[model samples]
Target: MRKLANRPGGPKGAAIIRRGWGKVLGGLTLSPLMAVLLTPPAAAQSADISQKVKAECAACHTETGNSIALPFPKLAGLAPDYLAKQLRDFVSGARKNEIMFPIASQLSRADITALADYFSRQKRTPAMVTKPQLLAAGEIVFHQGNKENGVPACAGCHTRNGAGAPRFPMLAAQNPDYVVQQLQNFRSGARTNDFGKLMRTTVSRLTDDEIQAVAQYIASVPPPAGR
Candidate 1:
């Protein structure tokens, strides 16, 4: 937020970054929230599952899945449904992050569910505020969804309310810088775990204006109920 120029995961305009796609789509699972209501022994099973995930992922993901540094996304309070979908996507080759592929690959359905459940319940720190001008631009893109460019509204998937379903994350309140980085990743194929291949195609067409507008808009909005 403090004009992080040239910093790691710094502002790189709207270019894409490519990474592995096929290796990310093997370990798929449903969200804990859903599993809990659906499964008979969800509570006890989920507790054990969450513990296992922490032990495995905490080394790099840090406590509560919130990284202290830049570039790494703050996983605390992410939407469980979104997280579960991503883990599945990474395994299924729909999404492709170099770091995420291997980690996701090792996860079992239970592990993915537990991780999503844990992180989705944590709180998201605020996105650093910078480039108000850019954020203003990002707003238009988010609400409008760039029909001319064939991009759908982000709210459609993440939900306008920001109470994302079991696997779609609540983008509201996330770091604009992080969002920008992800968009660039999606555009360039760096982070492809985007649902339905929509983000990849949509992000690819996003201009500097669109990126700034969408990211800012998402950051400006407050998380919805249950987020």
Candidate 2:
């Protein structure tokens, strides 16, 4: 009913009201889907990122998030939430990585989020196939399980294209050596971070050759668009 702009101290009151509104908006949280769709993408958030953290990450994984060395797994085009969880797991000792544990422990919640969001947006390059001969065998094992042994298809969880969801990791175009090592870790019970021991169970009965073949095929798979 009152026109504040026309009254004494109206301008200051309006400025205060505007600041209050900004705080309210800043405090509001976005839903998962909305956050992805509405937030300024990782590239645009560079100004707010910690240069020290980013540099450390780029030292192992290239600035683009692809690690050509094949020792550190590629991070490009992975789910941000998935990446965040891995970082947290490293800090919690759920995923025991001597190198990662200290680095992750130093990260604040904001740092973890920024790192995940940044890496997830980086473009991922397709991996090179080391064993061309095994592609066919690998394809079969990836798309269809060994029914006799009750092995479930890798695609059933990682998706047909291996653009994994928030819980599952992106397997397509990942380093074959890295994949093999992770599978072996799962099999040996060295890695227990997988929910419900799903990965351990899945790869438990798979032969070493089968694991290698699948990793090879997965390495060769070009990630689908918009992963």
Candidate 3:
């Protein structure tokens, strides 16, 4: 496994090897128990914890990563490792959100993994309201890369179908508020560690309305099938 240098939008936590063979072991070479232990957890172990976490998450993140308002991304189908890293970021102050830090501080690494896994496993539903103007602009931004501005399409890295890779989080059904804040962080150089600083440059040029539109459009989109 190679250690990717800190870059924008990349995992924001202790320097765990970003890529590991654990994600590649197959069948009998890795027994189920071994797989469980070797693999970072994606969701919680018990109903009690799941319920507790869900309630806590609901205070900020909407059910399954959806937010009640713009910029709060839906959490339903993000990659578990990615989610865990974000939680770790909050706890370590690599990322700063007044509400998120304290809440994340209460969780153990295992707990973060479990919650992330559970959300990643869920299906993302659309936001009930979509502003027409923002949707139109966001649609253009999501599918069409802005070359002059040096912005890549969201699909370039998130994948055409929005199924993100390991450590790359799913953004299809995220809360717009969460997404906006994250993007703003990128623009401000606060959220570094992404691959190539792509998102930082992308968000830097966006107007507030553009941000809202893009976030809303992405959130309203459904997760890729089987996600």
The model with the greatest TM-score is 2
RMSD of each candidate?
22.9, 8.2, 16.4
Estimated TM-score for each candidate: 0.65, 0.79, 0.69
Per-residue lDDT of 79 in model 3:
75
Badly placed stretches (over 4 Å) of model 3 are: 1-44, 62-65, 69-71
Task: Write the residue-wise lDDT of candidate 2 on 13-52 in tens digits.
Answer: 7787878878987998867676656667764356446474
Candidate lDDT values, in order: 0.70, 0.86, 0.71
User: For residues 1-227, could you state the per-residue lDDT of candidate 3 as single tens digits?
Assistant: 12343443346323333343334443248766775576554431555456756678876665555556554566776777788788888898877778788888988876787788777777777654456567878877888856777767887777665677775677776666677788878888988857667677778877777777888787677767766
The candidate, 2 or 3, that scores higher on TM-score is 2
Candidate 1: list runs displaced more than 4 Å: 1-54, 59-61
lDDT by residue (tens digit), candidate 1, 1-227: 64564344655421212122223323446586755565677667766766765666676657666555546666778767777888888888877767778888988897888788888787765555566666666666776677887877777777765556564667777767777788888888877665578778878778877886787777677755545
Residue 135 of model 1, lDDT score: 64
